[model samples]
Target chain A: MTRTTYARAIGTALATAMRDDERVFVLGEDVSAGGPFTITRGLVDEFGKDRVRDTPISEAAICGIAIGAAQSGLRPVLEIMYIDFLTLALDQLANMAAKAHFMSGGQLSVPLVLRTQGGAGQRAGAQHSQSLESWLCHVPGLKVVMPSRAVDAAGLLASAIADPNPVVMVENKTLYFRSEEVPDTVEPVPLGQAAVLRTGRDVTVVALSGLVPEALHAADALAADGIEVTVIDPRTLVPLDLDTIVASVRRTGRLVIAHEAVRDGGIGAEIAAATGRAAFDHLDAPIERVAAPFEPIAVSPVAEDAYLPRAPQIRDAVLRTLGRELNREGCRLPRPTA
Target chain B: MTLDTGHQITMYRQMVRIREFEERVKRTFTDHPGVIRGHTHLADGAEASIVGSIAAMRPGDQAIATYRCHGYPIALGSDTSALMAEIYGRVGGICGGYGGSMHLADIARGFLGTSAIVAQNIPQGAGAAYAAQLRGRGDVVLTFFGDGATKQGAFHESLNVAALWRLPVVFIMENNSFSVTVRTEEEDANAAAGEPLATKAKAYSMPGTTIDGGDPLVVQQTVADAVARARAGDGPTLIESLVYRLSAHGNSIAPPGVPLHYPEHEAVAIYGAVEEYEAAKRGDPVPRFRARLIESGVLTGDQAGAIVDEAQAEMQAAVDFALNSPLPEPAAALNHVYA
Candidate 1:
């Protein structure tokens, strides 16, 4: 296995898609300069200027034009420099690209990929730090994809590009530099397929994006105490693999869904509702969702730290789902030795 | 002026057909009462603007239109039964009945689609042209939106990029004298067409024109010139076809059997002063163009009457087709959401 950073994997996915298909092109403000995240760096040198268009700072054109290009026999991978700017391009992405195929009665397909990085660990402040996957998920014609690991990022993005519909790939900002083992030849991770990272019969923990690793770490920590936890990563949100999730929940009979988006109206809430309906008879305990509170992510490091979910928070939620109560002193463990 | 007699007759027939079709759709509701069972925007006054310009385009060239769009696909020669079925929300509609009057599309005929959002079709048209340029295909794209859409940022950005990349596209602004109810008056006839909006195209380094939308042949000749320029790789052009919304912004979606509020000849406060309506009525292209055709002796009144008769029969057939079409199965919705 070749070791690659999450950002590198994204670049490789783009290069592969471009090499595989001549119809694929990349456009956005400063994309030729590799964008603010540097994921698209050096792709221009290989594909040439025509395919890697450096658009004006007009998000409307960046998105709307991409949709137009898609329908007119091109697959455009458009980058919205920041998820905050998605508001500006929502008309084209939500109303135009997402609705074209269905609204057109299958006459046109918008094979477009709108890529943006979101989440708040780097203190980029409120605007740049929102996990707006829920907004895209709300739009019926769109496919929402978030990959937690470097390997999955490359695979999922490849599949998203090959699909005939519009896909929103919201990457986690904090995962850019994270390195992991990647295969020499990558296989596309199909949309709506969940990956079971750990096997445990006691409880099921569904994690998304940046929180997947935290959930894994928390599960390992819980394993030390003989309370095993099942961790599932729902790679894609729209064509969600509910069968895998509900089946897991039915076995565990308890669930804890997690994400970096706000606690209310986040994707986790939808997952909770779905599992609640499908696995209602099988559930032994009430479902728990570990996520950021309903406040906007703060710029201050201290406040941001408190806002994001930690391994212990996920572990504690899992522990609670397992019906573990606090000691008389209200602490989970005895006082630490000096 | 250089148009052949055959082309002029074709243009006249197209104009009369669209006018007759919209008139029939406007005044004839079945099953209960009112004109149409659903609300639809008519192309009564803007037939010249739509037909004149589109006549210059070759078949299969990419095109887009705003909400008042029946004229666009009709001018492009899309199947009448399909367009009417779509507006009727039947399974046989162009969009399989999913898209109503405001969202008709026939991508196979190269009329890419239509949208309800003001000025939204501009950038999308530009993108199609961008694709053409990338593939080295010198196909020109024509996009139509109302004057109210000029205020949208997409209009400016689309023109800017189309000009910057030398993308083959024609940005047609149908300046129909009103922003729904707000009067956007310009002094000179030409100026009123698109003076402010067309002249602003200079900022993007593209040629812009404010032409006589009242004359279909003029619009056709002018747009044909721009289409040539685009195909020759001269980049995009902005042509503002000044016309009037001779009808209501759109017929109200009144339920069958209720007295329809927005009629063809009723002038009310919602449409501005009666004087404006009266003035616009005098400029209606349908009767004026028919008179001109008769005066030129290129055609007789008998010929114009026959064209209307044929258009009426065809429209009646389309209405029958829509009424008889089936509904989309309920399970069809769950499919095509992906892929």
Candidate 2:
């Protein structure tokens, strides 16, 4: 195993996929120059300009071209600079790429991977920092996956490129520079599988994308007071590993979902509703959701920090589910071991 | 560039076949109400342009178009019976009735499917061209859309990239004089300024030409030159084929339980221009091509009559087959959601 940043892992995955398959190529605005976050750095030097292409600021056309190329027997991986810009290409993504296979009655399949990042910690303003994975997960023919660590960043992307259907890989901008030790030869993490980071019995915390680390921190903090928590990271959202989540909830009897997106209509609501139906009788208390407020991500660092959901918020939600609360001084009173 | 007498007759036959197929689709609204659901667009007046452009394509060449899609696949030799059944939403349809009138695709014939949205298919065609370039084959792709699509950003973006990359693609713009109910001149700056829509191609540094879409031979020659240039890896070309649509934009759209039928041509219904519509009818390309062929001694009147009779009979059989095809199982909707 070797230590690497989340950004390098993604770049390694791209180079690996391109080397393994001649049909796999990359295209987007400034992708040849490594793009804004530098996740695609050095791809052009290795793959050449034809395979690692730079395109104009045409999101819709870029997406449509990827779809067409995929249909014509080429595997194209396109990058939309930021998740906020995905709105400009929604028509092609939601209409053409997602529906091509179903509309053509299985005659066509778009093996295209659109890699983009979304998070609100960089003070990049509302236009650049919105998390919009919910919009993509709602589509029928689309497979949405989000990776929270360097290891998953490499593994999930490899699986996405090998996938036969169109997959959207939503990465986290906040986690890009974080260092983590990953396997020397990263293995493809199958989509729609949740990883159980920590095992406990008191509460089940379902975290997504950027919130996985925060949930782990909260679990550690709560563990100090004799409260045990289980953390699960659902790597893929569309074909969700609901069976694992339901099983976890059934054991813990308490669930708290967390994400960086707004609470209303977010993926948390869907998971909450689904879990409520599946394990209604197993719950010891009502479910709690820790998410951002229903407003645009602010430009100021202070307001953005307060607006984002973090470990403290997750910890508080876990406390609430346990019929307890954290004081205003950010102190948790020790309780009897559960 | 001259086509042989036999090839010319074959082009004439394909044009008649498209006209007959569109005429039958139009007649179904009255002859058998409720058979075709949702929206259905006809390619009555653009038959010459469709046939001529498709004639320029060789085997292994691909074509993508907008919702006015029936003509290209027919000219490319897809089964009319399955095409009609797809429009009828039957189980035996080309797409298993998953795609209706607006989304017809015949991959085996190199007819990549269509996008119903205006200008959406342009970029897709460029992408297919990109793939063809990588395959190291001389195959080219033809992208078909209407004059209205030129105003969309997809058109400008695709043209710019296709030109910059020197992809093997031909952009065929059939200027059918209207975008739904509005006249083209009212919505297009080039048309308002008395310029052919093809002039927009110059911005991308590509060859652009305007031709009389009512003449198949002229369309055949113009598209052939563009296709050859694309195959030679020079760049892309944009051809504006001006033809007047002979029907309304589509069948009248209404909610369920309200009968649907074809409304009058927008020229008469919206613009109150009966004389304009009548003039277009007098110059309809189907009969106009027939007269030119006969006068030039390329085909006798008896031979043209036999061709039309054969197309009419063929389309009649297609209609009967569609009417008899079974409806798809409702549970089948769950299939094909993934590969």
Candidate 3:
């Protein structure tokens, strides 16, 4: 096993994929200069200008070109420096890649991967740190994958590149520097499969993207109180593992879904609804959700922290589902490692 | 005019088919209550531009056109019924009823697709041609847009890129003298075309020409030269085909004259006065080609009418098939968002 930062893991995956397939190429603004975060550092030197293309500041044109290239059998990995910038390319992402196959009656496929960074925590402000996974999840043909750990981020990205459809593999801007032990072996994690980090019987906690670590911490804290909690990380949002989530809820009879996206239309709502509908008979308590409030994320660190759901929120939701109360000490559970 | 006669006639028939089809679509929109609720633009007068360029391509060649794409796809070999069903929003339509008249895309026939977004297809068409060149497929692409499209940034950018890379693509400017109510002359053609649309091709270091688009055969000759040049690895070409739209910008908008450049009465007399029967008959390139075929002794009028009738019947069957096709499964709508 090689221990590496999330950024390094992404670079390694790109390097490995490019080495294996000549058709693989990278394009985006500032990509040739090692990317906005230096995630693609030294790639241009090795892959040459043809493979590592630096495009103009036209995000839509970049994505549209990638779609055209992918349709023509080129495996293009487009980097949208930030998730907020994806709004500019929404037409290509939503109208072109998302609907191409369906409109073509399955005769054509767009095997393109868009690797973008999202999530708040770096105090990068509203525009730089939004988690708009829900917006992508609304589109039917696109696959939305956000890995919780360095290992899955690397593995899932490889699988996404191999997919015959368009894949939006969003990495957390906060997680780029977050290091973890990644397996040296090249593994392609199957999309739509949820990873159970911790198993408990009292509540089934489903978290996505960068929130899984915080969820694990909440589960660990709840475990000490004799309240068993199972933490499920949905690696992919579009091809959601509703079956696993529902089954876990059925077994536990309680659910608390957490995410960094806005609460109203977030992936958590969908999961909660699916769990409620599928395992309603097994519920011992109502489902609880911890998510960002419905509003434009503010740039202030204080406001951003308040905007994102923390571990304490997750822990509180778990205890609430278990019918437990922390009194005044509930505010001082433990700071999240995120 | 030898072996190409069959192909040329095929191309001519394609034009006739589109003219007829667009005429029928206009009639359908007018007669069928609650069919198309908005302004509908019929390519009533632009038959030559569509047929001429389409006839210039070989198998595996690609085409990307504006919303006025009826003739391009017919030339590219899309089924008439598929097009009819598309206008009808039928389930089995080319885009599964998702794309109506403005959003037709028949991938199998190499009709890359059409977008309602004006001038949006320019860069996309260039990209497709780039892909074809990169793949070494020897396939050239023909992209068409209206006089209005030439004013878009995408048009200029795509032309620059296509020229820079010497990509196998042809950019056809359908100078139909109007963009809705706006006339080409009113928009300052000198500034827009930059010394005639054909000379603008020279800026990209490629050959360009303006053709008489009133004659589909002449248009075909010009387009064929460009297509052949592209296939021979000579790079991109810019073709300015000067044709008349013949109708109001669409069903809702009045003719070009009402807005300014030309007289409204003349615009109507020329474009709107196209008899419903002639609009439907020569509406498609096939009817005009059939007349030519009879004059040339290649076939009798009866034979050509039979072909047109058969084409209509085939289209009717496709419309029925599409209309009867099942609606998409509710859950199927959730599929394909990511891939």
Candidate 4:
């Protein structure tokens, strides 16, 4: 095993895919120059400018070109600099890329991967930090995967590049620099599989993307209090690993879904509704959700910290599912009836 | 760029086939009411431009078009019966009823399908050219769209990239006078300023030319020159072929209860310009080319009559086959959602 950051792991995955297959190439704005976060650093030198292409700031054309290239027999990995900017290319992504295979009646397959980052930690303001995975998950032919760990970043990316359909890999900008020990040769982690980071009997806490680390940390803190919280990370949002989540909910009989996106129509709502139906008889308490309020992510660090859902909010959510509350000074108290 | 007698006869035959096929599609609304659902756009007056542009392509070359897509696939040698079935949304469709008139694709014939959205296929055509460039093959791609598509950002961005990378693609914009009901001059800056739409290519540093779309020989020569330049790795060229659309934008869009039919030409219906529509009818490319071929001794009068007879029989067979084909199974919709 070797220690690496999330950014390096993704870069390694791109290099490995390129080395394994001559058809694979990378294109985006400043991708050859390593992009804004340097996630694609050192690729141009290895693959040359022909393979590691830098394009104009035209998201719609970039996506359409990628789709066309994929249809013509190249596996293009397009990087949209920010998930928020993806809105500019939604017509191509949602209409063209997502519908090509189906619209062609199986005569064509778009083996393309669109990589972009989202999450609110750096004060990048509203435009750069929005998590729009829910928008992609709503599409029929798209597969949306978010890798929270360095190891999964390499593994899921390999699988996504190998898959025959269009896959949107939404990385977290906040996790780019976080370091972890990943295996020297990371295996392909198949999509639609959830990882149970922590197993406990008290409650099942399902966290996504950047919130996985926060949930694990919350699990550790709750373990100290003998709560024994169970934390699960759903690596992919589209073909959700509902079986594992439902099994955990059945055993624990309490659930909390957390993410960095707004709760109005976040992925957490889908999971909650699906799990609520699948494990309705097994539930012992109401399901809780820990997510951002319905508003734009703030630019101020202080307000942003309050805006983001973190370990404290997750811990409170877990506590709320157990009919309890955590007051100031970190003390557990009896339930407060409304 | 010069076409021999046999090649000219073949071009005439292809143009006749497209014209006959479109006439049948237009007739289907009244004869076999509701056999075709949704919107169906026709390439009636643009037949010569479509046939001429496709005639420039070689074996490995590919083409992508807008929703007015039937003419290219027909010229590319896709089965006419399957094309008709696709328009009829039958199980025997080229796309197995998955794609209707706007989405016919025959990849084996190098017809890479089309986009229903305006100007969206421009960048995709550049992308296919990018792939052809990477393969080190001299193959080129032809992108077909209407004059209205120039107003979209996709058009400008794709042109800039295709020129910048020297991608092997040719942009063929059939200037059919109107976007839908709105005339081109009302929306386009160049048209409003009394300039050809091909002038837009000047901003991208690529060669742009304008030609009469009604003459098959002119379109074939112009597109052939552009194709040769793209194959030599010189970059993309934009050619604006001016023609007049003889049919409405599409079959009248009505609810299920209201029967769909082809309305009058937009000029006569919207602007009351009966003279303009009549003038375009007088210069209809199919018969114009047929008369030219016969007069030039490239095709005898009897040979031209035989070609028209064959095209009518072929399209009649297509219509019959589509009428006999069954509707696709509802469960089949679940297929092709993933791979």
Candidate 5:
């Protein structure tokens, strides 16, 4: 096993893709100097300026170039600097990238990956830190990938580069420094596939991005209460690993979906709606959605913590679905007096 | 470079076809309201502006234009029947009826696509150029927009990126002096009415030129020079074609059923009567070019007249084909949503 951080894994994956395919290139602001988060460091040195091009401060052009390059026999991985600035490029991303292939009667293919960072733990203010994955996930043509682990970052990006359609990789800003034991030779993890982090029969906890590890922690805590919650990390949200999630929910009869995006119109809502219809007959109780409240990520640490969802929220949600004791936040009570 | 007489005639015929097609589509809407859906923007007086610039490009070069895009595809050699079917919302359309007049795209001809939003194509065009540069290909991209697009952030962003990277891109701005009903005066208080829109290209370290859009031959030469500079890896160029839109901004920009109030020359003239206004329609690109072709001996009067008649017949056949084409199956919508 090789230990690596999410940022390094991303850099390695980019290097690997560039080395393997001459058609694959990287572009963004300060990307040659690595990136704002240092995920693209060392790429320019190895690939030279031609492959690892640094673009001007134009999100629309960055994304538009990716789309054009993808359509014209190139795989371009572009960075937007921050997820909030994605607003400026939504016309190109949503209207142009999303609709080009379909509207062209399948004559064109946009094999592009839009890489951007989003999360709210570092006090980077509202504009810098925002979990806006739900907006892209809502679009029809776009594939939204949220990697929670270092290994998945490398694996998913490799697959995204090779994917025949447009994919948006939303990297959690806080998880950039997080390290884990990844394979020495990282293998590509196919998109629309979910990984079962923990095996439990009592309940199913489906989470994404940074919340996956939190859900696993919650599952460990619930084990003390004789409640085993199945934790499933759906790496990609678009062609969602619904089969794995629904199968797990059918086995457990209760479900809890967690995400960092706001509760309203969040991706968790879509999972809840899908699972409700698919596993309706087997569901023992209503689906519980554990996500941040409908508010922007605040600068204050305390307010941000309260506004975000984590392990405690997942544990409480699982217990409540199981008809266990109630506690503060009106959720289920904690493990008895351990 | 001087275009051969055959090439000039071809360009002229294509321009006539574009005008005839738009006029035919407008008649379809008037003669049959249900033929087209929603509002439509027609490129009537801007034929030379669109056709001349496209003539400067190689067949493989990518071209993107604005919402007034009907003329560009025809100028780029897109199938007229498919374009007509597309506007009529039929399965046989270029985009299979999914993209109407506002979103006509023919990738086969290197026409990337058109965006309804003003100046949205600027950044996208820059991207196409960037990709070509990355691949070490000499291909270039021509992005056509309006002076109104100059106010859009995408326009400036595209220029900055194209200049910084020295990408092969030609930014063409058709300064028609109006953004819908709002005149250029109200739209841009910064620039004078007759100011050259091309000078804005200097901020990005690229050559900018303003030319008379009424003459196709001049437009062809100027854009050919810009496209040459781009293909030579020297960088991007901004070409502002001073033109006009003889038709309503959209089908309903003017009064409910009015064709056009008057041409800009007659509208501003003190003694500009309706007859003079009608006479100024002679300045429209089709007739003006027809006269030029005759005077230049590139084609005789009989030959030019024959070409116009041929284009009108072709347009009528396209309308017939569009009306006859079937509606796409409902399930087709779910097919390409992913790939």
Candidate 6:
């Protein structure tokens, strides 16, 4: 098994999908010449210009062409270069691809995948750092996937390629160079499936995409202090794995949902709602969430860190879930005087 | 008239089908209660634009259009029954009643679809044309939008790309004088009446033409010329069909003074005269051709009337077919939400 970065895993999946199906092609600005971030290096060499195509700097046209190609018996994998630019193609994604099947009485299917990157930490600034998984999940026909690790990246990409509908596969810009061991085989992980990173009975910590690793680290630290924490990663937001989240919350009796997006209208709210509805009776405390503050991400690195959720916030949320009162210093739950 | 007749008979039948079907749909809107309340942008005056353009295409050729798309789908081989059911928002409608008036799609008929958003069809149609070009087949694409849509950014962008790539697409603009109550004078102060709106295509180094949309034969000749030009790899052509809107922009817009602006009071009388005169012309299609059918002893008026009657009956039966069909299962909505 070759160890690879999450970025490499994505490239490998693209190459594999292109090799497997002649209809599958990639289109984006600078995608042929190493892409905007070098994720697609060496693909053009193998697939040629016809399959690995470069497009003009038009996001709307890119998405529109992908929809047309998909409708006419082609699987077009479009890259928006950045998730923030998805705003430009919202009409194609929202009105065209999402409603094609339903509005056409199931006669049309948009077998397309959009790979784009989001999240903060590299000082990419307000324009490029928006986490829009929540915005995409709002649309009915769009499938949303955000993978945290190398294996999940490759697995989810293959699944999205095979999907009969449009899928928005978001990768974290900060995690592109982040490395992990990716098995040689490409096994598509089923969408709406959540992975339990750690098992504990004290509290449940649900995180998404890039935030999952921070959540696991926080859980490990808390476990050393005798506070066992269960960490969960909801891989796909649209078909949210509510069953697993509810089961974990039912066992732990506490929930803390975290994501990199701003607190309001974030994936955390959807997960929090699902957890509440499914495991309302099992709750020992109110469900809590840790997310970025509702403000434009700053261009400065120091401010960017402050804008996103961090390890300490996860630790504090976990501590609060265990019935421990938290001050600036940390945990302060007094033992019961039975 | 004759079963072995060429496009002449076929185009006439298709145009009559469209004109009659639209008229019947208008009657239903005024009569049906509890039906959807929205504007049905009927293609009454512009029937030739769709019929003539579609007549020039082959079986595998493609079509796409904007909101005023009922004619294109009907002309492109969609069953008249299904189309009527769609406008009525029945379960058996082309889009399962989800797309009321603004959206109509029938993939089986090669009428890709229509969208409510102005100019959205431009880029999508160009893409399909690109696919046809890539396949090395002589398949052509016919994309229709109104004069109002010509002002959109996608229109300019799509034209640029289409001209640059020399894709096999024919752009037909039904310039119907008004973009929803706003007269063309208020919007396009420079465009002369009866002149081709090809200024944009000029910038792209492409050719364009203007034709009388009220005359299907003229419209047919112009489109055939453009399709031929396109098939020969001459790139896209911008064909403007100058016609008047036979009715208000939508059903909601009532007469100017009498609370309902249903075209001018004499609009129907005028179009009716035109239809009659054209029917009377010896060379004109429709009734004259129907007469030839009877004169040649192939079929009697009663037989032709029976076919029209059967079409009407099938349309009525489709309503029942739609009404009896079950509503989509609630779970099915969630099933397609994701792949």
Off by over 4 Å in 1: A326-338, B30-38, B185-195, B253-267
Query: Which one is best on lDDT?
Result: 2
Tens-digit lDDT track of model 2 for B1-339: 799999999999999999999999999988998898798999999999999999999999999999998899999999999999999999889999999899999999999999899999999999999999989789999999999999999999999999999999999999998989878889999999999999999999999999999999999999999999999999899999999989999999888877799999999998899999999999999999999999999999999999999999999999999999999999988888998
Weakest 10 consecutive residues, lDDT, candidate 5 chain A? Answer: A329-338
What is the TM-score (0 to 1) of candidate 6? 0.88
DockQ winner, 2 or 6: 2
Q: How accurate locally, in lDDT, is each candidate?
A: 0.85, 0.93, 0.76, 0.92, 0.85, 0.78
Candidate 5 Cα misplacement greater than 4 A, ranges? A327-338, B253-280
How many clashing residue pairs appear in each of the predictions shown?
2, 0, 25, 0, 0, 4
Task: Please tell me which model should have the higher DockQ, number 1 or number 5.
Answer: 1
Candidate 5 interface CA RMSD, Å: 1.4
Q: What is the DockQ of each candidate?
A: 0.79, 0.81, 0.26, 0.82, 0.63, 0.38
Q: Residue B167 in candidate 2 has what lDDT?
A: 94
**Per-residue accuracy of model 3 over A1-338 as CA lDDT, tens digit each:** 88898898989899999999988899888898888788888899999977888777777667777877777678899999999999988877887787777665555578889999899988888798899888998887889999988888888989998899899998997788876887778598899898988899889999987789888888777766667889999888878988988888889999999888889877777887877888989999989998888888888877888788978889888878878774335344664334
Tens-digit lDDT track of model 6 for A239-310: 888899899899999999989999998878888887798899999999999888889999987788778887
Residue-wise lDDT of candidate 5 within A153-220, one digit each (tens)?
89999999999889999999888887788999999999999999898999999988889888888887
List ranges where model 3 is wrong by over 4 Å: A224-226, A326-338, B1-11, B26-41, B89-100, B150-166, B181-211, B221-238, B247-339
Output the worst ten-in-a-row residue range by lDDT, candidate 4 chain B. Answer: B1-10
Stronger candidate by DockQ (1 vs 3): 1
What ranking emerges by DockQ with the best candidate at the front?
A: 4, 2, 1, 5, 6, 3
For B167-248, candidate 1 gives per-residue lDDT tens digits of: 8899999987667656665323334674465776788999999898989888988898999899999999999888887787
Q: Which stretches of candidate 6 lie over 4 Å from their true place?
A: A325-338, B1-5, B188-196, B232-234, B253-339
Q: Could you arrange the candidates by TM-score from highest to lowest?
A: 4, 2, 1, 5, 6, 3
Write the residue-wise lDDT of candidate 6 on B93-167 in tens digits.
Answer: 777766666788998888888888898887788777777776778888898999998877678777877787787
Model 2 Cα shift for residue A236 (angstroms): 0.3
